[model samples]
Target: MKNRTKIALLLLSSFGLMACDVATNTSPKTDPNTTAQTAVVSEASSSDNVTKEKVETTKAEVVMKAKTTSDGKLILGEQEWVYIPGLKESFKARVDTGATTSSVSAVDIQPFERDGEDWVKFKIEHDGINSDEIELPVERWVKIRQSSAEGTQRRAVVVAWLQMGDYKAQTEFTLADRTHLTFPILLGRSFVNGVAVVDVSQKYIQDKHKE
Candidate 1:
């Protein structure tokens, strides 16, 4: 009877140890909820990249036309009529983007003093040999270095009203000996860059004022 009781106690202890092993045998399982959250975060990151690209494209399109028209239409032909309100005169002007500063034909330049400032008198002779003496305060002087000239020619600079069609601007101009040149006035990039677009094939496209 003693041996039988000892055997029965051993069997009870073995059963309890088996039960504990079975409870601790379960390994960690990957959570389905966590995998779903990771996928959603990945999708959101892709969406953000697409939205950023769209914004950049829109910004570029909007800024592309900044240097375009301002107050009025800025279009010009190869040659057009230019009116100087200060001089009450209008003349044909050649649109030249190649040149840097606009020029007006002048001859017999005589320097003098006015209001304690440097002034100059120049004559403009056009059709039928008609000449008009223009006198104005010399704002500044520009040095002209060209391939055709023997030396640097210093010319007088002045601001004058230049009108074409409906566009009018008080733009800077330099007095030059343009008698040898074809056109009396040459409109340069200073007036063309931000003010006008030159169409090389067109000429005299703007309306001319009548007397």
Candidate 2:
């Protein structure tokens, strides 16, 4: 009887060891529904990021389309009519973005003194026609390098009031001989920096200014 009891206890211990080993080796089952939900959430987050990028790109495009600023400025073309209040005349102007300062056609440019201040006398000459003699105090002088001529030429700069369409402002112009050029007035970046915008494809976008 003692031997039979000992054998039964050994069998019971073996059965418990086998059950514990099976539990340790088995892996927990994953729920298919929960996995599907997680994938959907990740996809949605990626889509939202893409949408935000598109919104930022659209705002930049809008600013580019609205070329004009809040102040009274104009969208100028490759060529426009510019009126000079000092000369009381208007001339065809070429809008050149490459030039740093504006220039006007002048001839017989001579520097003099008035009231102990430096002054200059010159006449606008273009297409072989000479204008009336005009005198003004020289604001400054600038040296320009000519592509066709040797060395740099010294030009006299003067302040002048300009009118184009509805926009009007006082800007500096370097007096030079532009008789050989097609346009007498060459509008440069200084004049159009804050006053106008240039569109190279179009020409004569603004109407001729009237008195």
Give residue 204's error in model 2 in angstroms.
1.1
lDDT of 1 by residue, 86-176 (tens): 5667788999899888988888988899889988998875653446777888889888888976889788888777777767787778888
* Cα distance off (Å), candidate 2, residue 135: 0.6
* Candidate 1 clash pair list: none
lDDT of 2 by residue, 133-205 (tens): 9898999988888798899988889988888876678998899988888999999999988778888987887
Local distance difference test scores for all models: 0.81, 0.87
Pairs with steric clashes in candidate 2: none
TM-score of 2: 0.64
Q: After superposition, how far is residue 145 of candidate 2 from its true place, in Å?
A: 1.9
Least accurate 10 contiguous residues by lDDT in model 1? 64-73
